[model samples]
Target: MSRPRDLYDDYTPSQQMTDAIKAWEDIVEQEKEVRRAAREAIAAELRDARVERDGVEHRVSQEAVARYVPWSEATVLGIAREYKVPGVRQAKKKAADAG
Candidate 1:
């Protein structure tokens, strides 16, 4: 098989080589920035997903939730709402119901 072209082939370091190196450096820096941004975006999404998962767990028993998996997201959500987790609080009911 033919060898792939090396962008930075061994050559006498000259002004042209220097310029090429600088250009390559810029590309590398730009790629690093792009990777960083993608990582940040993924991290943000993971944080949001974890928060959402916690909210569902808060509403439903954490242990029971595992059994309901493989269900549709909406169905799982419905089940979570239907089966309240113990010890989590909701808004206080009206005093009339407090008797």
Candidate 2:
């Protein structure tokens, strides 16, 4: 095994290094495009998600959506707001009642 080299040393970028960086940049751009599409699809579904309560259909709560998506509730709300998802709102927490 080779010993670690000093990372702070001033060095010229080699052709291999430059090519690899360009390749990684292209890959990252493609990943961003795919992620954008996925977010839009997920947001659309989340916006339309519904549940039956008292024999009437209602939009699922953002908290529930967050749990189902396995993302933070705030993150889910952020995406909803970004995508203009309808019927989703930030929930207000109520303090416990004092006896």
Candidate 3:
């Protein structure tokens, strides 16, 4: 079989390439900002998250947060920890109304 000729085999940098690269970089930066905002929002929500169990409310579990967000459980916990969200370091065993 013969190898097909590649269109950019002898490619040279051009102004158009520079503009395209700049556009891609801007988009990547914007995406990063959006992801950061999302993580912050998730962390804040986790801080106030709660669930009722056996007639008592408890802080939401990492698994629950993972299910709500698009990321994995570990990612959710990491974000929660990064933001210093409560219940990330140690879960509360006693009922919310216990004390």
Cα lDDT for residue 45, model 3? 81
Q: Judge candidate 1 at residue 74 and give its lDDT.
A: 50
Question: Tens-digit lDDT track for model 3 on 3-86?
Answer: 997899687789999999999999999999999999998887888877776896777777777897889999998998899886
lDDT of 1: 0.52
lDDT of 2 by residue, 14-80 (tens): 9999999999999999999987886786687787877776696777766777777656888877888
Clashing pairs in 2: none
| Clash totals, every prediction | 0, 0, 0
Ranking by lDDT: 3, 2, 1
What's each prediction's TM-score?
0.37, 0.62, 0.69
Output the lDDT of residue 56, model 3.
65
User: Whose lDDT is greatest here?
Assistant: 3
Rank ordering of all candidates by TM-score, starting from the highest: 3, 2, 1
Q: Could you list the CA RMSD of all candidates, in the order they appear?
A: 13.7, 8.3, 6.5
Compute the lDDT of residue 86 as modeled in candidate 2.
71
> Which wins on lDDT, candidate 2 or candidate 3?
3
Q: What TM-score would candidate 1 get against the native?
A: 0.37
The regions of model 1 sitting more than 4 angstroms off are 1-12, 50-99
